[model samples]
Target: MPKSWPDQLLQMLLTLAVILSTALTIFIITLPSSYSHFQSGEITEEDFTEDDRQHAGRSGYSYYHNHRDTDGKLKTECTIQIVVLGDIGRSPRMQYHALSVASHGGRVDLIGYVESEVHPDVQRSRFISVVPIKPHPKQLQASNRLLFLLVAPLKVLWQVFSLYYALGYQTKASKWMLVQNPPSIPTMAVAQFVCFFRNTRLVIDWHNFGYSILAMRLGSRHPLVTLAKWYEGLFSQDATAHFAVTNAMARVLKKEWAVEALALHDRPPNHFQPLTSIQRSTFLASLPDTAKYAANIEDGSWRLIVSSTSWTADEDFALLLDALVDYSARAAENERIPKILAIITGKGPLKQYYLNHIQHSKENGKLPNVDITTAWLSAADYASLLGSADLGISLHTSSSGVDLPMKVVDMFGTGLPVVGWSKFEAWTELVQEGKNGCGFDSAEGLTQLLQDLFGDDGQRLKILRQGALEECNRRWDDEWMPVAGQLFQLKP
Candidate 1:
């Protein structure tokens, strides 16, 4: 049956009306208080506590109340306490950045959740202090583990709802509340009003857009996106400053939330002294089985190493695998087996998946020649491995921008020529193609680049031995220190 034009038009209008009504309903029902007068830039601990308690009954307020230090008076009058509600595993760059700020004479306190054990070296790093917070049990489960997955979101939602209501009910204040990878909704809900409070500077570090991750995970649009959008709006309207690791993220922040955010280029801290050849070899000798995979590669094969946590989906190592297969096939004609290796370090939900995928490929003859290894390595061990690699790789998805991968920085510090995708703005700026390293837009381009470098031994050796080290020293300077110092103003 053919529908008439008027009938089709009427149906379309009805659908549009329903969507508009739903959106309006959400706005009126879920919107938190947009307090305009609380614009002062200084606050006391008591005031922050009082506000949270007062707002305990509100629908969307959540508060992370830090108890007052009773042992001694606040020694540093202008000490900045930056509370980051995220995992330590995913925040090495932040940790180093905080250390850099502290090195430049800013008193910095980082509050976050860490695993049961802390690495000794990480504990000894100067310029930063870590305060441990309790992590939810569900966070320990693997990403593919379904038992925790079914109930985790619900628990997170309830926690967020409770926290939001509590914070809104009391009006507890802070000088600055930077929610870096908060676990759930209520934290963001509370953060909205914290921005509204006169003395509070609300900063949301958009690490990986949680809403987008959730969308990809569930294969559907979750209601949390709507809530996140509302908080994003609140931050946009009232936040004193907004920052993202990459320009692409900044673009999303501006387009979706109408917030103008600065792209803060993350650089490595200068504390790590250049390891001598002997010291570097000694450090590599102490690494675990998986961490030392790079050492097994023959001298002639152009080895490419990727050092990152297991869970980062944005790395796109699959492209690297495909490219390696292609490289091997081409090299075979010249009586050569392309001796390329990929070493994946760190642990996360995707650990097993990555392992299984790689193992299956090798077993099924898809990637017969390429050697793939995965491991959970400490920070020091990972750094040592980076020093051993000939070339580093940092490939991110479209959503990423000029985020200088900490691995890239470590590789540069070790004088390894980097071969990676040209998408990340920071990489493009730091790595001059065929000088210190090479960048490409496609797998074929990268393969060809690798072939060229492999064939030209002299040029490749120059980059690996000297050019990259010079680039690292030149880039890791004091220009980015101000961003860390700015955290001090948030202290009460």
Candidate 2:
């Protein structure tokens, strides 16, 4: 009854099998991975090159950029390294270029500020690598930037050497180095040296002739400005290829600076999708009750005027303020005019100063007929708000007289038509009258255009918004591919 001899033998065999399986599982689970093996003293890390271990035991960026091949070899496939001295957040141009490369399954080695991480969309690729620059002597100090410009060459030379040594330690023979200009005088000089040492071809993306940009903050005839211009023109000769953001910029580079350059305009990212009404409502909700119609834009009763600014001097936020006040005063002359909610979005050098001034103006009964709010939103939030707005207003009238406004490009990407102040030479090429939107030369003209654009019936507003969305569908990566494709061929 207790089980015969044969049954007892079978039960014993089953217990033995269970014991063996348990032991085997423990052995496999405890086996060392690359990192663990290296740590445990079993694997000699000296045998594997530094680049091979580059991705090991690192956080967000380096983790994705690991160089382990299937055979456990440390391998790096990144041919071109994009270098920007400042934060990628500070330069959407650099960010977009790196992201575009990642999307195409091409590996990227990006060197920039610590605050920047690879944008989420590009994280899909395991090939994206980022090397954060070491902290500067006094970067957080507000006066550091002014000090930087004065000691520009020295500060930038230090950075170049620092990154060169760091890069030399990690990887070998990076084929090409694409450098962003302005901080141009220093960047071009530093990049040329780095490329020479690394044996990488140097390419410059001239966002603007650096001297023109420097003249905006520093005086046009200041020694530093003159020195910067001369040096920029001098060092630019070393660049194998130059990319100008506008045709006018390319012309200036060729005729004035005596450097051959090509025009390759900027474009929005692939993920800047058309915003739906629901998404717009969600983004508007993130704003305080004072903005975007007190979070009650559902009825579309109050006209929502949205503008994005970088808070730079050249952008001239004062122009938008003047136009807003002008329109408000005109509306007050007639009570029949519609109520308005003006949303100005962005953060920058003058952001806090302007925000306080705006609040003070409203409290003093200065902006009585209109409510204006500044909403500093994430990139995603910004795109949503741009798409939701009745109209966008661009204050950028080209500080350099050549470089086009990326803010306007972003607005157009959402198909949110904009009424922009004209730099005639630059803005005229982008903002078409009664097509994408209108352009203005004065605050009074902008005020008049705003009223005409958002008329009580919203008829013309609908047409402009639709046109914006259609234009938004134009080339992003494809537009830049021919230029980027050239990088693959430019060896030595």
Largest lDDT belongs to which candidate?
Answer: 2
Q: Cα deviation in Å at residue 158, candidate 2?
A: 5.4
For residues 336-410, write the lDDT of model 1, one tens digit per residue.
434566677766655676677777877777665567777666656666677766567766543335345566666
Q: What number of clashing residue pairs does each candidate have, in the order they appear?
A: 25, 3
Candidate 2 is scored at a TM of: 0.78
- Per-candidate TM-scores read 0.69, 0.78
> What is the Cα-based lDDT of residue 345 in candidate 2?
76
Q: Report the lDDT of model 1 for residue 45.
A: 41
lDDT of each: 0.56, 0.69
Global local distance difference test of model 2: 0.69
